[model samples]
Target: MSFVRMGIVGIGNMGSAHAKYLIQNEVPEAQLTAVCDTNPEKREWIRSQSGDSVQFFDTPESLFESGSVDAVMIATPHYSHSELAIKAFRRGLHVLVEKPAGVYTKQVREMNEVAAQSGKVFGIMFNQRTNPLYQKLRDLISSGELGDLKRTIWIITNWYRPQSYYNSGGWRATWAGEGGGVLANQDPHQLDLWQWTTNMLPKRLRAFCGFGKYHDIEVEDDVTAYVEYENGATGLFVTSTGEAPGTNRFEISGDRGKVVIEDGKLTFWRLRISERQFNKEYNGGFGQPECWKCDVPVRGVETGHKGITENWVSAILHGTPLLAPGEEGIRGLQLSNAMHLSAWLDNWVEIPLDEELYLEKLNEKIEASTFVKKSQCAKILDVRGTF
Candidate 1:
């Protein structure tokens, strides 16, 4: 194929953002051939954006089988992601989905298998993976410059969203519609980045969550989770959508030193020697390892969504490796689930999550929800710098 015929399933905020850039020919080996959205308002919007060149399908079934595109990008709600991806895979098309792969891992696991069997390019929109700050962090960890991980703490309360943002649509923040709150909607990137950089998953976790703590929503808006890794490294994750004048800071401490990412800068505290070795060799009673604070230079601007879309096209046409493979999405979602499950059960949740139990508890929350969803209207927001 000269270029991958790209189709998008949801033309809401994120979807429309991708659609606009694609229509503008921002991605090198991709073209906007078609778009599918159940909302008629979205259809009208897509037409105005793509003119007569792009075909609009009201249903995924039509778009997948219509022969209008060679690949599909799914930007639907949290629950429908895996189901639609599986369908697109069965239709013999490449699939690129938005974050949090699915509400639960069991369903996402099935989708991964189908994608592997299809042998099609399956990717998730982990745009934060393209950030230079995080990319450098992963390099430092993988290259052993940071030695073994000791602890990680990220207070990412900058996901600040007013109640109006949640009230923009009925399906938002409701357990039945959007699954969870900040973790599902706002902080998937941070959740994904935490492990993507460290290459470690929590062995067990204890979390405290406040559902509708700062908003009139049925899902969590504030959360504080404590997690432990297999290697004995512990982490603290704190996030909220209600906190104003919020702070965004991530610190990764390792045997060699630690790196701090805040205010769009990476500060590396390098020890002259590994802490493990220092403990063995230091003769001074209380002297610590000599350290130097270096401003680790992170070059290049983060490509974000447009970059991921371009990478997906490159993978489709030339066998280039995807920056954010779809399978890796499950790991991040697993962390999110662990935290939620811990809070729900009011106990520590272990790894290898009990998928059945998670789903059961999730359903209980949904069944218990008395707040009625208002409307699934396409009230698209101007999501310029959301990620």
Candidate 2:
């Protein structure tokens, strides 16, 4: 039960949360060796909390070169994820990265290459995958109880961000900073969940995205993506930062029935089969032929970010399988980028999206744009469940 030496880069909102989870819990498996952030104040704040007298570095490379850490958790901006992950991996350190592993599919592929070469575990911080409700849904789908998942619609609009929420951080909502909105920040969880539960990637996508429709942000604050999966299944993914009192409702309809996750509960509606043998042969069918809403209770720890972090640390330190791997991250990022590209170009973008083209378009904007002034941003109105 030796503790794994750990270092964290970027002490922002998410980074700080990972640090807190590591130090304030029964993490007999990890020790915070150092913390790194360019901001002096953020570094100082982490020092005060952990009281590790741990060393702090000004740059990610410095943290890697210091030889003071065995593993590193990267909580930097979306654009920086690939660079930091590659650097840490090359240095022979295990890495954990925040959601949307890279801003684009190409960048993620490059990161995957580095991890493969390094032969180190690369974990993505898609914490929402650890939710029992999602876990059960994934299990049910994989178990084939649903009889071929046909369609999934995830209406997750409840990620409420106030104007000050975006204003509180300097590197938020800007293309040069976060790469995109809602999809990149608030909806990464839902996006990842969409792929994880269905276990299918869309073959093509058409999206309608509203940039600055509700907020004064430069990227999409609202998005609706129409997806056609390889198996001919369709999906509708919609989300927005403008909506308040929003609801998170996920429904998957298969040939047999439907699985709905809402209000923190999972309900399975089983379609009564005409073949009594099929019902009798199945483990969960109870030898009955009928359609009933089966309540699937959430199991395990309370659904929260901390639980995911604990599993992340444990999975790496011990031999526990990661809830979300870095490679799986690429699918979610591709989905997000596809939607953005489709909306931006006003055309259907194919899956395994044209990474080079997307990068080119993004670079053009990056080179031509000027940073938006926070003072110029319009006040975001608080609306309820309107995605």
Candidate 3:
């Protein structure tokens, strides 16, 4: 097996988590070669945690300039994701970017273009896509076992956060730092899951948002979006950071079955649909298809973040096919952007959304922003709910 040297930019929560996993698990084909962070305190802490033997730098450029790493994992704040990933790619390094690939669709597209030009593996940290229940649900939909999907409703309100959580960082809820609220941070995984399982793109989006309903922030704390796809299939996405005792329930209905991904489990109901109804040509009930539901156990074993991360390293070193391609990330980001645009303008927006328009709207919010955010949580509310 070929061994790949690894470097990490931004030694924050996710970065630190990745560092720990790399060092402790001893990924068979990967090695932790360097770590980077802007904060002196964080730099010192990483040195203490990893000892003097490993290299540490204060800027991503320094790490990339060293040319000692084969790949770099970016766990920085949202704004820097695109720039850093592009930089790493330009230096002939494979990259694994943390979720919400970038703060906006345009930035994510630029990173994707750079990755394509560089001819190196570019991966997104959509770890939830690796979860067993979600995998099973995706498989069912792809296999035709679920038949033609009609509607999907994801009531994922369980992403509860308190006021102090937002206060933990100045950047947490600010438009300038993070972009949006629930959609950017807590719900990127869910948004990506929406696209992955549906296997379709939206035709239009309409939404209503509650801006800072429970938190003192500029962006939304809760949001509800109604999406229509090209085939006339519809979807409902509901997310909130203020709701307590929340539940994450995803219900996807098709002509043959309905699949629910919730509480780390997959439940599916297989239905018998009537070809007979079509053949009968009834005068009164001409279009209605008769159906009966039967419970079907989701087929697939479980795998989570560790599985995806390990596979990512393996894919880089051994050419394994990716679970989630980096380019597909833009789809979810576009969906989020369209929803926010719809809610902000109080109108429905069509899909294949205009990236320039979204960026213009984002810039407007950035110019208008007044809130002082200091940490990750603050930035979270600002951009997360926007989408």
Top candidate by lDDT: 1
Q: What is the lDDT of candidate 3?
A: 0.80
lDDT of 2 by residue, 1-387 (tens): 366788889888788887876777556577888989989898668768877567889988899999998888888877778878998999999898888787788878888988889988788888777777888889989988888768999998988788888787665787756778899888887888898887888999899999889877788899999899777789999899889888789999987888898887899898877333465577883455568888977778653666655666677767788777877888888899999899889999998888878877776554433453344321111011000
What tens-digit string does per-residue lDDT give for candidate 1 at 54-81? 9999899899999999999999887788
Per-residue lDDT for 146 in model 3? 80
Taking every candidate in turn, the Cα RMSD to the unseen true structure, in Å, is: 4.7, 7.0, 4.0
> Which candidate model has the greater TM-score, 1 or 3?
1
| CA displacement after TM-score superposition, residue 242 of candidate 2 (Å) | 1.2
lDDT of each: 0.89, 0.80, 0.80
TM-score for candidate 1: 0.95
Cα-based TM-score, every candidate:
0.95, 0.88, 0.90
Error of 2 at 92 (Å): 0.8
In angstroms, the error of model 3 at 358 is 1.1
Model 2 scores a C-alpha lDDT of: 0.80
